[model samples]
Target: MSTVAQPDLAVLSSPWTLGPLHLSNRVVMGSMHTGLEVRDDGGAAMAAFYRERAAGGVACIVTGGIAVSDEARGGPDFAVFGADGADERFRVAVDAVHDEGGTVLAQLFHAGRYALVQGVTDRHGRPQRAVAPSALPWAAARGVVPEELTGDEVRSTIEDFAAAARSARDIGFDGVEIMASEGYLVNQFQSPLTNHREDEWGGTPERRRRFAVEVVRAVRAAVPDLAVTIRLSGADLMPGSTTDDEVDALVRDLLPLGLDGVSVGIGWHESRTPTVQASVPHGAWVSYAERIARVVRTSDHPDVRVIASNRMTDLRDGETVLRDGLVDAVALARPFLADPDIVARSLGGRFDLVNTCIGCNQACLDRSIVGAPVSCLVNPRAARELAFPARPTRRALRVDVVGGGPAGLAAAVDAARRGHTVTLWEADASLGGQFALAAAIPGKEDYAATVRAAVAELADRGATVHLGRRAAVADLAGSDAVLLALGVVPRPLDVPGADLPHVVSYEQALREGVPAGTVAIVGGGGIGVDTAAFLVESPDEVVRAAEFAERWDVDVARDVLGDVPQRLPAADRVTRPGPEVTVLRRAGKIGQGIGITSRWVAVGRLRDAGVHLVAGVRAYLRIEPGTLWILDEAGVERAVPADHVVVCAGQERAPGAEETGPDGLVANLRAAGVPVAVVGGARDASGVDAVRATSEALEAVRRLAP
Candidate 1:
């Protein structure tokens, strides 16, 4: 609808037909488990969540893993096909999407050995153990050993998929997608690593794929009028697992099974390769989809479209892939969570208005992994659309928000969006305080895109922004309400030689270039780990997919089906020339404060980069001209070579900050009889958490709005 030229992205807005189902565009809202399906609201909350995204302009919505049976449930949060009140719950969601002129697909799901949790119950309130092709322990630490499904049970599970497809059609779903990817029960049967059976279900590669083939054939017959798709694992990215040739053959087999589409996904949950994390290059797995598309195009049924997904957040990339005719559609799951209107906005040539997902996974994936409701770090209202409606307030109040960092920007934009008169002030010349610094880190380029989008949104909402201007009481005289989002200053290190000229704060080191020499980082938190990565990695290597493939040992060409080596060939780290970096922590694990989903991946990258991680430091002995002295946990002293010392110890409240008194602005504003709300680092500077900061800002402004 936008007048601006969007020739490059025209294919994204074009129509496409997947057999019986036709879509208005090539963008699909990929399935993501929001942990909201089990809400007691009879699916009202989940319905609202889907309806909002449906209205935002996705061609179709894929419901998160709907269990075909009680034993198929991945967790307690999954929606079971035959549970009590299940029809009503599913109908509500289906009607909600249909009301918004969007089609919905039910993803039939079954967790095999991956079901490691215990409290999951059947509709009859009986506990069910996990079932797989073979009895395998998913992880030794958790000790979750699943029972092997008998041959009859495997056939019954195939029937379960057909029954679920029938239920989906009765519930008004336009289509059904069998979940055969991500190492689920169907995927488990396709791999020799998990499917050790000598029966019809496993043994040879052809036999190993029989379970998936049968499930598809049954589901297709069960829903002949509806679009039947299969989510296939293009490359498991696991060692000693299913090869690429077997997967290609499986695709060829499914092409004759009357499937309407194939949505390609990569990597098992247990694979050592990074797939969805921030470090992963955007559209890194598109090549796998392209390969499958090649197989599908040359097959008997060319109408079976292929959907590419995995770190795909940009529509331009989607357009390129679609234009090139490699893949028919592109699926983006988290980008929709960041901004539900991504499709509409991009189609309107207002791509700058899109709130890009920085792929932090802090609020979304991290929470979902533990069965918490999923939300976005940049947009917290995602999945809670009903709770935080954007309706206008009774009266528009003049709201003044101080600081232009993540929290301040979020407060200003959200306040304006709710029809309030808003003004924001940033002491720095530009916005994005901590976010700007983070943008400088490798693989975090999207953080800068987020800032640009936020700034544009503020302008679109007609909020006044003053940069390089510090807000004072005089500046806020005309404000009806005040929000203090004054973000943090670096918590100064207190050890000896901390004030040396060679020493720099993490902020300074990120904003400016570090001297080329051995650098010692005095903290092992997220910032410290990021700082180490930034100091050692070249900027060019971050965006280059080939470089990433080489470093992570991904076979981009897919000749061997993108199989990962059992153990990574040793990184030529010792001889690589750059600034030698060392990260030190007083106690606890490295990357302790990082989110669960990203901590291991980030820490592994640091180790791969040859960053020396020193933990359990007894004390910082001293710092000299070219060395940092430290006492070990064993009561021994050691000197670490350091031409430059960067301190990333954490954050603290702004200088001279106080919650009460004439000297404090908060107390002064309260004494002046103006409503005051404090948020972000100004409220609590325990650490620099963008998630907490933005959430606080949104909650405070919404509560304080007139």
Candidate 2:
């Protein structure tokens, strides 16, 4: 709050006005799935979730992918409903937001064959039975595609959208956004791969685009004055499907239909198609936005300002594209989940202190799919913020942050925001510890951005920082609480030949460089794989490495890693099959440590990389020179030529973690002598080395409290 804001450049300043509704910025909160509604009767926390965005200063808040008709219902209460009772109830929710001086709209949709059967019963709740273009399903399985919409079904479907739009308008929605993107029924029809029908509804470009066109036309006709927007993809980004040229033509045809704006997006690129999602960096698809926005900018369509939306979590990232004129507005889905009041803070000049969305797909996608309200892992108060705001303290407590990483940084931000005087001690000049390394991975750079934003927020929020200082237990003096986030140390194996010069550790490769050649890697844990991944091209290149790193981030969801990692795949890397890799796993299964899905993927890559796996082994033989001799399960010594051996057992406790934070959350807080907390890998450790160290650190800070 020290400096004045540089104009809240979010969706509020979108620059275009929709009738009496001029958004405060260009940060539109695009519609997403949050199974918050209790029933199709239109009840529960769904309204509050949407209202939270409005209260948070979103320029325009759109509904989740609601089912427009019974047949279109995917699962449970998708916001879309046709019953008069549902619209009336939705109106009450709209009034709550309107009363707050905010604008809102609903996105009307039909799941097509993608519709779910819902609950354990998997009732095809509302079945739109039928093949899309070629019976190729849109999303992950829920079984039994409804019979393709008959000619009768087609006419009824068009009416469904219009009727839904009319229903939305009557329910007091400020406007409506046609769901023509994200591989829904509309995108299915727009895509030639899915829509092979020739009867006026398919085959040719125009024919294929007919369904979306009709929806837009119908919605526009229904809401002549209400701002009617279209969510359209620039290109499908799929193989054997729509290309950029096809995208150009699609826009050319849709432009004359009188849309107030377009929410330009990318890939619902079928499972087989390369799509941009969680693993992808923020704004990776901006080109798609710019391309489509420009193509539609000709003539009166210029008024159809293009709104670029995605998991644009960081504000600066959003501003970068907006400043370039490539997009008029930026849509933030996950970030809002992390910090609902982000708008107020950004406007108030605390942009650096903004709690960011780490692009963890756990809350947004996973929870929704499993039938729960969407939320974030890091930010506990996502959708339910109204009920929780860091509670006021009865008295002041001093706080000390032992390490600077995601959890540590998060703790510092909240403690400071909660009015605690905090000091964070980082051993390295760089604040982030192992976290920086995690983010340094090629496809995971976005996590680095999250850390960067978190660090910036820490500085802005007034947490005093100590760089180049590693605190020992003795250092935990004179504080009220200590958060020992001083992360984990790599566990090194003690075998006779483990210390050769050619053998490198994953941490070293990340911090240094891998010599380019036929380097044989020796361990296959996440770190070992990280080392291999850094030096080699493909998992298959170090064929057995997939076995080592397969379990990384395994706790994210469904006994699997984060879902974001699944959706956010990077461009495949091609590796020459020379660096004959060797992995030694005690667990015979090459993919055991990793998730079923990720393991298959990684093992396949490792196979492609030609990595040789030697599991159920225990010893390494060799002190010098050229070869790595391994003891196989069969008690045979198999030797593989090695230029490098990277040891990647997971991280061990810091030099001392146990004797640290002993008593509990409070005792530990008092030990640090400052308000602090540990997170990530550090939080997982509990022993004399880790826990004792944690207790001592906490006591150090507790002494500082008044």
Candidate 3:
């Protein structure tokens, strides 16, 4: 295998013209429903969110899907195109993006069968009804069959799209994108499985494609001066849905109807495929863009560009895909959430200083799926950039942060950036606490990037770091304020014979290597699942890497395999006969507190690796020399023989000999006349991960900076 040279940064930052619209660069902020609307004032919060991204150097921004009419609305939080006073309301947001030298495009959408499934109400407090091409129920819609559209109703819906496009152009948008993807209303008309009508609208493939084609034609005719684009699902990835070939054919037909560009979106809301998750390798869906680009290049409209979306988080990967001629532009949604200045940092060649997205969907998509405001786990100021703007401190004061984990590191960096003298103390030789152990897991190496970014930011901001130094109360005597981010200590299992020689804590098992043979993990939470993945050897990492390389036309054996020894020792290292692992949990379900988007990916990998899962355990009987005993949910005693027993029950607050208040060590420190703040897993008895800890620490120290 041969290696491909890295793409030139200049070419990536160069300007490109798509139809009549001219962009500053090739980067596009892909459309995503952030759930940041103000509800009363035509999405004031959503407008401010877009303004921040525009100020950060994104060339073009595609606003989240806006409903064409009240019936087409997904929820009250979504912006409505033809609502009363909507044009005046949205013009402010468009002008804000324009002020920053960026172009904004509105995505006109209709949710169809998947609208307001969770009983979401409108501004009038009335439940929204879903309309579809057929009377089929989407699994995500909770068994609510939509009312099939009549021929007259279909024509009116197409007219509604035309009216929406005209309104977008009137409101000062640079362009309008028809939302014809993601199993929505437009996509339902394109897929044969969803559009089961016997009428002219849905019979053959060509007939099924009529609705989307008509929408494009009508929208283009209604707003002739504005650029008209359509977002298409390159492949639905669902059974009985449109195939790749059909999507290619559909794009070919729609291009002649007047589409300035095509943005390829992979999968649908109902598909079981992993579209955008941490487990999925980057550039996994570039081929979808390649297929659409091929069709566009072959057609008369050769200038029609293709925007490649779906997990193109890194700029290097985006540039590689562009240099390889897969797509004309790269569209990223979550990467901007992680670092709004991703484009600016890349252009400045300060890649090391950039906070890269780790592809963890916890705070972003998972929050949106449950109707919560969307934010980033890595960058907490994503949606609240304007609400919680950073300010410099009035005076420099000495600040001491005890613990070099995520929380402490964040507080120290923030303090130093705010013009304060900051010192961070870590008892261990390293910076990351539990984060280091998490990175050692088979497929979770990306977690290390968070620690690396935090450490680099701390150094760049001139925060003094003290490793292998335990801070006593006397050490913080001269500090104006002290922050206790001292993370958590593992809790020991209280079962009889837990102190046997073969039994070890989850930390020791990962740090000191697990013993060879069968292993039993006594908990099924995030730690236990990760430990099970660690002990049992699996091909998920290798397969995902190879698959990603193949799709992007890169040399895995050279670009990936050559760095295996350094990039991933867990995959290459071998022990005497891999262990057979079993995960036991007291609850009926495993992986509690795991994100809804990536939990299934972890569980699926564990299952494919032959790891056994025993849930709903009533009691832990005992642990013998090389065996452990437990009672099943049915009260039946089960003796499980194992060479090693690993307990991952959870974490507890760090022990302190001093008298503490309800708030623990923080209150105790304040009583001692030290201005103090507490954060991280140590503050919560149940424990918090890096995301929560970092967010809490940043917020707490910001208040103390003044």
The number of the candidate with the highest TM-score is: 1
Of 1 and 2, which scores higher on TM-score? 1
Predictions ranked by lDDT, top down? 1, 3, 2
Candidate 1's displacement at residue 681, Å, is 2.1
Residue lDDT tens for model 3, 1-706: 1124564565568789877888888899999887654345554656677887898899999988889877787766676765555676678889889988899999998999878655766656677778999999876777778999999999999999999998898889999999999889999988888999989899888899999989999999998888888999888878888877788888888878778889988878767667787666666677778878988888887778899888666677677777765478989998888888888877776666666777778888888777787888777777875556656777998899988776787788778877898999898899878878877776666667767877877788788889998877667767788888888877999999998989999889878887577788899998998888777643345555664454434323222233443444334443333227788999747877678888887787677666788899999999987788999999999987678999999888665312465535455566678788778776785846767887888787876666
Candidate 2 to truth, TM: 0.76
Stretches of candidate 3 off by over 4 Å are 1-8, 39-44, 82-89, 123-125, 537-542, 547-572, 575-579, 656-668, 687-690
What TM-score, over all chains together, does every model reach? 0.95, 0.76, 0.92
Q: Residue pairs in steric clash, candidate 1?
A: none
Global Cα lDDT for candidate 3: 0.78
lDDT tens digits by residue: candidate 1, 421-457: 9999888999998899898887787898888998999
Evaluate model 3: give its TM-score: 0.92
Model 2, range 173-281, lDDT digits (tens) per residue?
Answer: 8988888786778888877777878788887888887777887888788878788888887666566666678777877777788777888877662443223333333
Better of 1 and 3 by lDDT: 1
User: Per model, how many backbone clashes are there?
Assistant: 0, 103, 0
* Candidate 2 positional error at 208, Å: 2.7
